[model samples]
Target: MITLINNPVQLKRELLKVVQKELKDEELKVAKSDWHSRRKPIGCGLTIHPGIGCPMQCSYCYIYDMGFSVHATPYSLSGLQLVAALLFNKYFYPTRWGTYLAFGSVTEPFLPNILPKTLEYLKAIVEYLGNPCQVSTKMVINDENVDKLARVGGSKLSILVTVTSLSQYVYLERRAPHPLKRLELVSKLRRKGFKPFIFIRPLLPGLRAEEVDEIVEQAKASGAYGIVVGNLRLSPNIVKRLISEGIDVTKYLRVDLGKLKSGFVDVRVDGDTQTLIRERALSKGLIFLRRACCANTVSQLLSGYNDVACPSLCFLNEKVCEKSCPSQCKVKAGGEPKQFNFHEVIREVLGFDEYEVEVEGHTMYIKLKKPLRDEKSASFALSYLFRRRIRFIYE
Candidate 1:
C-alpha cells in the first residue's frame, strides 16, 4: 500500500511511528559520543584522535587536566574504518561541502610509539577520502616522514608545529622534542612543498617584545607559511599545577585571582599585546591568524575553501564553534530563511543521489526513487530540511 502525506501536519503525525519502528529491531546500547563532533571548534568538520592522551604533557594542556590521559595511548580507527565512519557521518557531505578532517585533537598524531601507524592512517585517509586534513603536533618530525606527511596532506593539509619558546622548551614541554628540532622539521616540511605553519601557543606570557620578534623571525627563516599566536588558557586544576611547579603565569594575563577556585578562566593576552605580535608577524611577511583559525585558514583560502564552519579556536578551549549568524556559510545547513532549497537539503541529509519534488495545490511532495535506509532517517531528513522539528510520510 502506498500512503501519501498531504501536509506538514500529516508528516508530523508519522514521526514517532517511524522512530519507534526504526529502533524496534536494534539492540540499543549507551551511545558512545563520536569524536567526529569535536571538529567544529577549530573550523574543521572532523577530528581524528590517533590516541587518547598525549605523552608530551605540555603544562597548559587541557586534555591532561581533564583526566583523559596524560600519556599517549592508541584510540583510533584503522584508516579504512575511519574513511567509512566519515563517509557515513550525517554531518559530512563531501559532494557539495568543503570539510576539513583534523588529526590530533585529544592526542598527538605523531607521538613516538604511534608514529608509524599514524602515518599509515594518514595515507589511508588521503587515498580513500581525500578530504582536507590538518595535523597539529609538538613532537619531533623525522626527516623520513616529511614526504609522506606532505603526500597525505595533498593540496589541503596544514601542518602546525607548536614552538612557544626555545629557551623554555625544557621546562614547559618536558617530554616533547627540543624547540629547535621541531623548528627544523617545519623548515624541512616547507622545503618539501608542504604548508608548514608555526604555533607559538600560550605565547609564553612574559616574553619581551624582542623575544617575540626573534621567534617570528626564526619561523619565517624556517620557511613557515604563517604564524599563529595564542594565549594561555587555564583551568582550576591547571592553575594549581602551575602554582605547585613554581610558575606564576598570572602576571602575564588579565585574570582575577578571586575567580581562581570557581572555574576555568581565560588568561587572555591583552589586545595591545596581541596587536604587537600581529604587527610583527605582518612586518615579517607572515600571515597573522587570529582566534582559532590557527593558520588553517591560510591553506583553506589558498585552496579556495572559505567555508570555515566555526572561525575561531574554540576547539582548543574545549568548546565547539557556535556557528552564530551563518549568513553566507554554505557548509552549515539552513541558511537565509527566504533562500530555502528543499531539494538540496534532501540530497545532503538523506544521501539521495536522485529525487523529485513535486508541487500539487498548496502542498509539496517529495518522491524518493530509492528507498531510504529506514523510516527514522526520513524524519531526520525532514527535520533538517525545515530547520526545525518536523517529520516525514514514510511508505
Candidate 2:
C-alpha cells in the first residue's frame, strides 16, 4: 500500500512527479505553457477554462474586449493534461483546503459543446487535487446534465447560476437562455444536493426595486441557499455596446468614457440598491456573499468537508463577511493557532533556509535572508497554507 502524504507541499510535489511520469514529453511541454499554469490575482483563484470564446454575446461581457473570438471552441488540453498543468503551477495547492479552483471565468463552462469538457475537468480535479471548486454560468442545464454534475462533484462544487434581469434578459443577454430558465437550473441544482446561489452579476443599471424583491423571493422559493451580488465592470467597447442597446450608461459612469481605454471600469451601484438586495436576501434567510470564494468556502463546509475558514482570507475584513453567512468565517478565522514552526514551513515550501518570522493576529511577517524572484507567488501560496496575510521583507 502506498503511504499517504499529509504535508500539502510535499504531497503536491509527489503528485506532480507521478503525473509527469505518466504524461508524454510533448504533453508535459504543452502543460507547462498552458495559461492555467500561472498565478492569478489575489482572490480570483485559478480559473480553469473548459472552453474559449463565447457565442452568447452578452452585451456587458468583457471577454470580447480581451480578444476571444465570438465563436466558441473547447479548450485544447484534455482533462489529465489540464491537471498536470495545474500541478506544475508554482502557486497551486493540492487539497480541498488548499487553493480555490474556479471555472468559467473566460467562457461559459456549460455551453453545449463545452459541457463535456467541463465535466471531464471537474472529475479530474476532484480525483487528483481534491480542491474546492466553483463554477458560475448563465447557461441552462437539463436534468441529465445535472445528474452527471452531481455524480462528479456533488456538494463539493459550488454552483452559481447567473440571473441578471428578468425583463431585460432578452435585450441584455441576446443569445443566452431566459432568466427564468436559468433560475430553474438553480432550483434543479439545489434539489440535487448542491449549494446553488443566484448570481446577480454586473447588477445592471435602472433595475426597479420590485424586480429585485421578486428575484429574492423567487430564488428563496426555488430553494437557493444564497445570493451573490456583483458590480458592473465596463470597458469602452462594452459601454458602446450597452449604449447601442438603448441602456443609459451615463448614470452608471464614474468617469469619462474616454478614461475606460483597455481595462474594465467598475461602475458603482448606489448604496440603496446594494442595501436593498442585502436586506431582502437576509429577510428571506438566505446566505449573502459579496465574493465567489466566500460561497466556495461555505459550500465546502456545508458539504461536510473539514472546517476550513475562507482561503481568500476575506474574514480579515468585517465588511466583506456578511452576517448572514452560515460559516461564521470571521469567528473561525480568529481561532486558528497563532503559533507554529515557521522555519520548517518556509524551508519546505519556499526553499528558504534562513528567515525571521512574526505573527500578529491573522498576519504573518517574514523577513527573508534574500529576495525571491517571485515574491508575489511565494506570499500567495504561504498565505493559503498558513491561512494568514503574508508580508515579506528582505535584507
Error of 1 at 345 (Å): 3.5
For model 1, what is the C-alpha lDDT against the true structure? 0.58
For model 2, the local distance difference test gives 0.82
* Candidate 2 ranges beyond 4 A from true positions: 1-5, 268-270, 335-343, 367-373, 393-395
Residue 68 error for model 2, in Å?
Answer: 1.0
Give per-model CA RMSD. Answer: 9.9, 2.3
Model 1: per-residue lDDT, tens digit, 228-300? Answer: 7665768877766666655677655666767866666655565666667778878887766643343554565
Candidate 1, run of 10 with poorest lDDT = 24-33
Top lDDT model:
2
List per-prediction Cα lDDT, in the order shown. 0.58, 0.82
User: Quick one: RMSD of model 2?
Assistant: 2.3
